[model samples]
Target: MSEQLKQQFTKRIVELQKRIDSIHHDFANGRHADWSEQAGERENDEVLNALESEAKIEIQQLSNAILRIDNDTYGYCGTCGEAINEQRLAVQPSATKCIKCAD
Candidate 1:
């Protein structure tokens, strides 16, 4: 992989990590509501929970991508051992498999 692409992916992963940290902080600081607001609070909490879960998964993926870069394995399909297309990497920097192997 080009140094430029690796740098971009690294920057993206760092940004994602920051976002995850913010979500964690928000979730931790969430407040309990009064009885009258409990129902709405529950619904909002559910949505926040879902968002947190998604962010956690993305953080994991980005972490793995960073590891791959460190190992000199970035941009290679994990399943097929082929060079992953630049377009695919641009769209999903954490992709482990090429489009064919992914299918």
Candidate 2:
């Protein structure tokens, strides 16, 4: 991989990690607005929880990508051991499988 691409991926990973940390902080703080006394509070909490869960999954994927980069296996299909297409990686930096393998 080119230095520029590597930098971009690294930057994305850092941003994702920061977001994940923020989500963790929010969850840890038990952020709720008088839910016992307010209507729709449970729904709001559910939405926030769902968002946090999605962020966690994305963070896991990004972390794996960083590991692959460290292992010199980043742009390759995890299942078939083939080079992952650049376009796919550009669209989804956390992709673990090539198109065929993914299908």
TM-score for each of the candidates: 0.77, 0.72
User: Which lDDT values do the candidates have, in the order given?
Assistant: 0.81, 0.78
lDDT of 1 by residue, 1-103 (tens): 4566667766876787777787778667756667767777678778877877887788788778878988999899999899999899889888999999999
* Best-fitting candidate, scored by lDDT: 1
Which regions of candidate 1 fall more than 4 Å away from where they truly are? 1-10, 28-33
In model 1, what lDDT does residue 46 have?
Answer: 83
Q: Residue 94's C-alpha lDDT in candidate 1?
A: 88
Against the true structure, whose TM-score is highest? Answer: 1
Candidate 1 residue-wise lDDT at 26: 69
Please report the TM-score between candidate 1 and the true structure.
Answer: 0.77
Root-mean-square deviation of every model = 2.4, 3.0
* Angstrom error at residue 86, model 2: 0.5
| Candidate 2, 2-98: lDDT as tens digits | 4565677667767767876776676576544775734565566577678767877876787778778888898999999999999999899889999
